[model samples]
Target: MDLKRLNYFITIVNNKSYSKAAEKLHISQPSLSNAVKKLEHEVGAPLLERSTRKFALTDAGELLYTRATIMLSQMDIMNKEMKEVIVGGKGEVVLGIIDSLKTWLPKLIYNYKQSYPAMVFKLFDVLSVEHVKQTLQTYKSHAIITNQLIYEEDIDSIPLYKERLVAVLPQEHPLSKKTTLSLADLEQESFIISTEGFQTRIDIINAFKEEQLKLNIQFEIDRFETAVSLVRNHLGVTIVSENYVMEPIDKTVIRRPIDHPFLERTVYLAYMKNRHLPVAIQQFLQSVEEHFSTNKPL
Candidate 1:
């Protein structure tokens, strides 16, 4: 079947309604139906079960849909590569990174450009482990730089560096007097831990549990800035990766290193293990490995 019909079929399946797919595709309903009909005719088997209210894909249709999705993705990539070649545009290194890497990323890109001038960088502030995993899987980012571990089988991870996790406390907080703080020291302090789904939340929870300390969580946040903001206001204490507080330490909050092995996080460079990466992206991955190998952010 032609790409157009396969696209129409996929759209219909995604929308779960022929009329909705037609509207989305900006085509007449009958025209969309005719395209599906032709596709089924070409396949010599009914692709959809007409008896169901919500159309169901037949076995043959399921196989075709799976294959077509991959084929279309490859075709789209081919078109993008062709256009880039025509315009003398090298592919971009699309990276999803945690917030801490914000300052040095541009420098990394600038330095990489010294070797490969044509390639460009696209950076996304992907913080949570779940968000970064989805970003890589969806091809929204070619790779990810993060500290959290990704247990997914399809993603390949390169260990970068271990960053110390430190506590952000209000200057006036009792524990702020200490040079290094333990979970025991902050047991009674109002805690501002990360939200439930984040790996940081899990790590912090387990760290407190291991110390047999009660985690008095007063605030749950997704952003480190929010944690810092709350800590600055003396609302609660929060822990963060040291890289996040490296520069621009304001007077309101005090950062003290957490004195536990579990408090340290290892930064990682992660990418889809099985996907065919573009040449520039492949080069970028290599360059990233080399860059981190020499310059550990820790």
Candidate 2:
């Protein structure tokens, strides 16, 4: 019931033994035990099963442990946010980003730091569309930059910019001679595309389907570099965001713009619609909007 007792209960569950929890908490075993007992009495549930030698949680104990951990984590986040407001110094931003956005995401993050020198950033690579949505939904990330269009009603999305998709082909492929390529043109070519859950793969498929073309997908890859490697080895071709093909781009593969309207991907900055964002995070999002609004190069 009380924060102190709940914390004590969580510590005991985490350490798995009274002696270890006591040591970690810098308290006597009896004191730790008393705290947990008080918590059990307050919650009206037997938290631990004493029948187990290594110690185990009762069904109720497991539930309490899960809830307490999440509660404590939110409390900590609130405390940090409050400190940032009063002290104007320390704060952290947890962000989820798709791989392709790395082309300019690092710079955007760096620019944010210039305004708030003490800002801490936790960057997570979220490539698959489903994974990115889950990251935002679960509050794992405050905001995300993704290549897919999320249709979730509880998520708010901001359009960043549209980047053209390009065809990556083997150096000697006859289609490489063209300045631009269409899905119909590459229908007969072996394809090395992203995995099934990836937005890139879905977009690629839709683009081809629109033209009534069938893709001969020979391989599935996660990274754009991997696609280049496969194409270089004469395995198959791939379609990906333009910047995904990093510079110092090798000669063994060639990139030509894809001509389909559906192939142009719009990057999005998405976040939980109802979540309260910390001020630092709000400013970071603002900077992104301003940059793209002015047509400044990312």
Candidate 3:
């Protein structure tokens, strides 16, 4: 299969218009259309549903698109590795990490850098596990550190650490003195929470549902820091990973563990299962394993 045609198909799908894809690809609209038709013939199926006003992919098209994305990503990695080999330099490793890992990820990277001094890094602080998975699938990131246990055929995940979730409250709040909290305790309080699609947010919602309670959500923010800051201001209480409890926080806020059954989540380090991982990535994975083995929470 022609990689160029596959790229054109991807561009068309992304732009959702033939003319736009042609313009972006610096080719004529007719030529682009013809190329797609040829591609469809080669694949023995109509890849697109062009009869409707809005463009849509056929079932076959969706499959091809998914596979082509991975294929192109692999090609890009191979090309970069080849270039690095020619230049006699270690290649780069891009990592996508969730916000909760911010505290420890730097130290892990620092340790890895000692072993692979010439390796370069690109870090993406992603908001959710979905975004991290997408980054890895698109080849924008070589590995991801996330709290969500992703079960995908092409992806492999290793458990790194487990942490409980706790309710963060203003020090002056009545619940601040409590050793443990429950969903009922927070039912009347205004809640500061992560936006939808985040695993923490989903877990919070589920915990509320389990107790047959409705949360009085006041704000939906992206980062844990924002949620914590809001709680510190007494705007609303929020739930956060226990890792934040270990951080040096403002005296105005306190964290209380939720009652049984407790809300605990495990963090995982994930990567593509089939990709030929570079030495730097392999060593970095080792560093992560070593760090957690010696330093994991009890």
Candidate 4:
């Protein structure tokens, strides 16, 4: 199969319009249509359902799209590896991490860099587990440290650590003195939470729902630090991972474990399953495994 035609087909599917794909590919619409026709002739099946008002893929097209995407990704990885080899095999490592890893990620990077001083590191802090998975799938990130256990055929996840979710409140709040807290206990209090797509936010919402209670959300922030800061100002109470509780007391914020139907999440180090990873990425993964094996904080 011609890679160019395959690319053309993938581009058309992605854009969902022959004219748009032609514009993006710098080709005439007739040429693009001819290429797709040739592809269908070669495959012996129509790849699209043209009768539909909106662009739609036939069953064969759907299968080819999925396979073609994987093939293109593998080809891109091969080209990148070849380029790295041609340039003496040094490459940058990109990592996507959740906000809770802020405390330990820097230390891990610093220790890993000591051995490979020339290695370059790029980091992206994302809130949603799906975002991390998408980054790995698109080859935008080499690895991800996240709390979401992504179960996909093309991705592999390794258990790193488990931490409980706890409630954060202002020191002067009436419930702050309690040794333990429950979602029901905060029924009257306003809740500060992360946005909907975040796993922590979903988990917190589920926990509240289990008690047949709904949080009186007053604020929805993206980061845990922001939620903690809001808690300090007595804006509302928030729930966060235990790992995110940094030292050096804020003096105004208090953290307590939630009781009854304990909310806990497991952290995982995820990577592409069959892709050829750079040496720096492999080394960093190994270092992370070794470091966390004995030094798991929670």
Best by TM-score: 1
lDDT of 3 at 141: 78
Q: Identify the runs in model 1 with alpha carbons over 4 angstroms from their true place.
A: 81-91, 115-119, 152-154, 274-283, 295-298
lDDT of 2 at 98: 71
Q: Mind sharing the TM-score for model 4?
A: 0.83
Better of 1 and 4 by lDDT: 4
Q: Any residue pairs clashing in model 1, and if so which?
A: none
Q: TM per model?
A: 0.88, 0.73, 0.81, 0.83
Model 3 lDDT tens row, 173-258: 99877798888999999999888778888888888888889999999998888999899887999999988666868789998888
- In candidate 4, which residue ranges exceed 4 Å CA deviation? 34-67, 84-89, 209-213, 249-252, 296-298
Where does candidate 3 clash, by residue pair? Answer: none
Each candidate: how many clashes? 0, 0, 0, 0
Report the C-alpha lDDT of model 1 over 213-250, residue by residue, as the tens digit. 88998999878889999999889889988888988779
The total of clashing pairs for model 1 equals 0
Candidate 3 contains a number of clashing pairs equal to 0
Ten contiguous residues with the weakest lDDT in model 2: 80-89
Provide the overall lDDT of each model, using Cα atoms, as 2-decimal numbers: 0.83, 0.83, 0.84, 0.85
